[model samples]
Target: MGTFGCCWKIFGVALAAIFLFFHDLCASEKAPNYTFMQNATAAPPISYYDYIIVGGGTAGCPLAATLSQNASVLLLERGGSPYGNPNITNLSSFGAAISDLSPTSPSQRFISQDGVINARGRVLGGGTCLNAGFYTRAASDYVRNVGWDGKLVNESYEWAEKLVAFEPPMREWQTAVRDGLLEAGVLPNNGFTYDHLYGTKVGGTIFDKQGQRHTAADLLEYANPSGLTLFLHASVHKVLFRIKGKPRPVAHGVTFRDATGAKHKAYLKNGPKNEIIISAGALGSPQLLMLSGVGPADHLKAHNISLVLDQPLVGQGMSDNPMNAVFIPSPVPVEVSLIQVVGITHFGSYIESASGENFAGGSPTTRDYGMFSPKVGQLSNVPPKQRTPEAITKAVEDMKALDDAAFRGGFILEKIMGPISRGHLELQTRNPKDNPSVTFNYFKEAEDLQRCVQGIETIEKIIESKSFSKFRYDFMSLPMLLNMTASAPVNLLPRHSNVSMSLEQYCKDTVMTIWHYHGGCQVGMVVDRDYKVLGVDALRVIDGSTFNNSPGTNPQATVMMLGRYMGVKILGERLTSDVVSN
Candidate 1:
């Protein structure tokens, strides 16, 4: 076989070995007893579950696994199973997995009202199936702020770590990133630890040593198959409600459609403890709630949908941790790397880096500037004169040179960890199949813009640091036809940057989301501390949507921790000695 084919065959063999190993580990426990396919033919006729969880995503998978330990549970996922999907199992396909815009791709790509391109997972593992795979325990302050018991939170983290999280092997590029972060004055290096702290540290990742990704779906191995039923490609349209002349409405069941458009209704078994939990991510949770008529009455009325509850905050206060980056082109090849090292600054910014062949393929360049399109160029305030043939040719040539460079070097990503600006989600149409309108309102607050500028400035400082000198390239040496001066370099800045180009305008033009969307159905506003939606019984929101604020990092770890916490609470279990000691 050719090299690529040989590699693929070996990868398949390795993955099979890993699967067998994990299967043996779960041998003492019950294997997942659930049904998953394209249709709902295997669904129980009674359709009664002690707990019916929507969106078998990052949060829903683990939560269902935990709850099924004691009660009958059902999980409904809008996408197919993650098992054997190369896009999900192979680390090399990370970019393509998230960027794939095909209707059947696991990721559902959407453009926000603000014109930013983003995506969310439609798969069983949710974001964990699509995200960059970085994992870190939520900061201690985050636990305290959420009013979670510290002991329980710690135990919950341990439970998740034992399943999917792993310590990544340090690569050459990652070590350089660590040195550069420390050189940027991020502070005393904390070495390697999963604890979120103010310094550079290596954390856990879901990618295994064999370069294979293990998703949240793997946690379902702990589930009792007899008690839990999982249905794939089952899109839930709305949460069914019942009112018996009471002031509040109770969630009785859910109405969903199978892949073949067959509709099914799965209700909670009649019991005081039976419930339906919505874990459909930040955008999805609120959209589902609004679709079910639990949002602002006025907004619901405008859509001509009868209101079941007058809760005004169901889809308000959406926050996505916005990110801006500096792509450094290197004439020499760099080693493949993911987000193993991270720099946490005190000023509400987190710095991270990624390097690999995947970075090279995804980087913006002159030849592929069409990806930005006329719309983005116009929104960027690009002057008509700049579109001249001569300028366009020169820009394309420069971009080609960068692309042809031996390696797709590293990228410095500055994420506004604590953004003050808020956004909201609204219905586009009442159709459950249609995507909701998401307005991030990024950089709306003056302080938010300033924070982004600070982050960019920090990135510049890191690039210029002596520790980064080895990775730096001499762009000045390239054959350029444009007016090139040592002081000015090339005119790459936006209008906001005058002599230095508009850093402010550049931010506006280039900013993208890190995909850590949260807080649409926030606590104290839409749900209570116990995750119960206000004015609704037998229903709860248990995903990133329930976060009152961002956890200041990649949110997969925290999302899983929350799922485990909620599962324990629903089971009425106290913190065990083993859990506490771990």
Candidate 2:
């Protein structure tokens, strides 16, 4: 009997091994055929593509997938795939993912000319692979202003949501934030809606129930694999222009370097519709244009780049939302949280919070919860008209002071959704690998500073509300009040002795970017309503750089929606039932 049982077990094990081998083969067949370690030997010598999309980021991935439905599309990304990176896939490693500072990490961190630290995504999924995973549809006014078809935009939002968006499971810290926002008069309590509104609401997130991040690259699953070719680590240097003293320049192909540093050129096929799209992001799109001699003639000349088109607006009119935060340390443990709740105030400010314990694992007793700074722009080398010398000098001084402050506890991030001031980005050198000089010119306008002050006051009110009274504590013998009294009027300045100077001074010094850079290649100025570059044919700039204005919220969803919208337009297709009701 024992010998018979052993024989049966052996047979079962052999059968299981055979089944696993077949399963592996099937899985490999279904996986997208991405070119790994691309080199001269790997890529064909004169490859032809109907459409070549640069920068496989937040906007590029979806756009390429959508365009590949009928056309042969080539999507080139600067960084490798995001598939097995623990820092990118895990929610707890959110800070380290962006703050890694490694050259090969998915994120490329850089400091602005104004001395504020910021980072942008370099991976296949772009910023979507590295951001806080917050997702929300663009405001209706933004849709109308950008001349996007409202119905189509809505459909595109659904398309992206179905793939990566998810409703977060609320936890302790998020619940407290929602209640406090309501108590502070950001009312109506819209309750778990993705629509952008002027009240507290639980929006969508890209992280699913398992806390695993689903990036925009996942949407490539819907792509027709037979028609799409994705080349990872294929860094595009410039758009090859065919200019024979013609009135309008034509883009014939692109020059890119593979991971092995061997140069390759991929040209557009012989079709009138064949084109190259630059979705290299707010900073990248402008840099590429300038490198290809399509930006301001004077700026390009300074860098010794031969001018193709004197499109002055190519790298101009840059703007980014600035953030300011106030950290409140709590000795007690706070629940681990991301941006599960948001408070949109009437004063053009958005309030969100993140738990420190969620990022830095430690015992509950040592965890700190503090409100960080509001989002704001940085001053550039050539300061704009609005950036006064006083403001610039004060900003440098304040950044130094804020850096020295102790970091403890969970903090609220107050971001000004809209600002009147605008800055510009220009190339420091002609090298495509060199980071551009980005100048946000934050608080150039007094109104912008005033708006920031209003946001700071609003944050104070929420922190003072009874909803947060449970976490209140004292410093020395005095209560940590954030320097406000219940009887004080809204306009009254904070009386906190710990504050360095006036509220405006504090704002000028501590302001930082929420990394929401936009308007480098604005719609009306750089690209037409259809996103085609004005002075150049067979080229379009799609990405955050094309945004006419910031979307007043996290722009990941809007960027993806725009990609889908453009792809549908290029395909010359209307919203079918399958596309709309996703």
Distance (Å) between predicted and true CA of 119, model 2? Answer: 0.6
Alpha-carbon lDDT of model 2: 0.69
Q: Tell me the spans in candidate 1 whose CA falls farther than 4 Å from its real position.
A: 1-41, 44-46, 92-99, 362-403, 476-499, 573-582
436-543: candidate 1 lDDT, tens digit per residue: 898888888887788787777777777777777677664422111001111111122222223344567656755667778787899999999999998989999999
The sequence of per-residue lDDT tens digits that candidate 2 reaches over residues 1-582 is 332222221121111111111111001112344532232336665689989999888899889989989889988888877776654445433333432446677767666766665667778788877666789887898888777899999999999999899999987667877898899888879999899998999989887787777777877876888788888877788899888886778998998887678888999998777889999999999999999889888888988999988988887888878776554544456765667788887778788876543333221232211111100121122234655657644543433343111222455667877667788899997767668998888788787788788877777776677886554444411122232211111111222334345677656655666778788898889998888999889999999998766784788999998888899998873234337646
lDDT against the true structure, each candidate: 0.70, 0.69
Highest lDDT scorer? 1
Off by over 4 Å in 2: 1-41, 92-96, 361-408, 476-500, 573-582
